[model samples]
Target: MAKIKKGDLVQVITGAKQDRGGDRGKQGTVLEVLKDSDRVVVEGVNFVTKHTRVGQSARGSREGGIETVEAPIHISNVALVDPETKKPTRVGHRVEQVEKDGVTKTVRVRYAKKSGKDL
Candidate 1:
């Protein structure tokens, strides 16, 4: 699975729109990660407009309108942001010990390569 996950803050580092004067260096939370496709939906990024036809609700109320929503972007275009440094960084995994109910176990955790802190 990809290291990026929902709620992770990421910055656009490369891609057409992320180049030159686009959303480059802009950071936002990861909304969804499409692991199978190697893509992700980030908040306030890659917006697309969709027009919906008028329809009835379960209660027959009604619903229809145009809306703008985030579109999926290639995962390679973004990099995780370091919490402490507030800069873009790569992700790395490490094993840590945890104890619960008098039992100790190891778990994998993500950390920022730049800040060297748990992400």
Candidate 2:
């Protein structure tokens, strides 16, 4: 199971502080997870400017320009936010058994160690 998943709230744990115009301490939703590359794209974080060629679509609408978009950041640089305290916290997993339809199954679930709340 992944510690960080899409839609999870996370805070930048590394890099320059926000006072220095960096993203550190900034919290945002996890937009995407690049497992193979060990990177994650967080909303409103790690923004990069893209200069695209100006062109027109089939409908004759102008397209493409200098746009700032979120870029992927190393997964280690982010920490999941604890729902209770609203602070960054380490994740821990625990296995639990649940019965449904007369069947019991074991499932690994992630929770925040700080608040002991399920993630």
Candidate 3:
């Protein structure tokens, strides 16, 4: 199981302080996970501007222009937020048993170690 998954709330643990115009300490939902690159894009974090060639749409309306979007950040730089404390915390996994169709099955589940809350 992945420690951090999409829709998980995460905080920037490494970066310039927020007072310095950085995202450190800021929390946001994980928008995407780039597994191949070991990176994750957090919503409202790491904003970057994109410039596209000016063009016309099929309806003759204005097309491309400058746009701002979130950029992917290294996964290590973020930590999962603890629901109880509203702070960053490490994730842990445990095996749980459940009865399905009269059969007991073991499943691996992720949880927040800080508050022992299931994730």
Candidate 4:
């Protein structure tokens, strides 16, 4: 599994409108992980229209209208944002040692190459 996890900041990279003129890619927290489908739902990306029907016997119930809501995008479509530079950067993993019970344990850690910093 990759290091990309929920709450990590990410930028949309391969959508139709992403990184377009006057509309740079948006940055937001990863809301969910759809690992089975290889997709993720960002907090505020890939908006879609949702239509709801008005129930009968409701006062002033006009025809149902469509509401726009954020939708899920594929994980491959986003890049992790570097903490230091505040820009999107590729993710890489490295083994680091951590002290536990007076013993050093090696753990996989994610790092950002663009900023040369551990994330």
**Could you tell which candidate, 1 or 4, scores higher by lDDT?**
1
lDDT of each structure?
A: 0.85, 0.92, 0.91, 0.79
Kindly report which residue stretches of model 2 are placed more than 4 angstroms away from their true locations once superposed: 55-62, 115-119
Supply the TM-score for candidate 3: 0.87
Quote each prediction's TM-score.
0.83, 0.88, 0.87, 0.74
Highest TM-score among the candidates is held by which one? Answer: 2
Model 1: lDDT to the true structure? 0.85
The clash count for each model shown is 0, 0, 0, 0
**Predicted model with the maximum lDDT:** 2
Order of all candidates by TM-score, from best down to worst? 2, 3, 1, 4
Which 10-residue window in model 2 sums to the lowest lDDT? 110-119
Residue 89 of model 1 has an lDDT of: 85
How many clashes does the backbone of model 4 have? 0
| Stretches of candidate 4 exceeding 4 Å from the true structure | 18-24, 53-66, 115-119
Error of 3 at 56 (Å): 7.4
lDDT of 2 by residue, 15-91 (tens): 99899999998999999999999999999999999998878778897777799999999999999999989988898
The C-alpha local distance difference test score for the whole of candidate 4 amounts to: 0.79
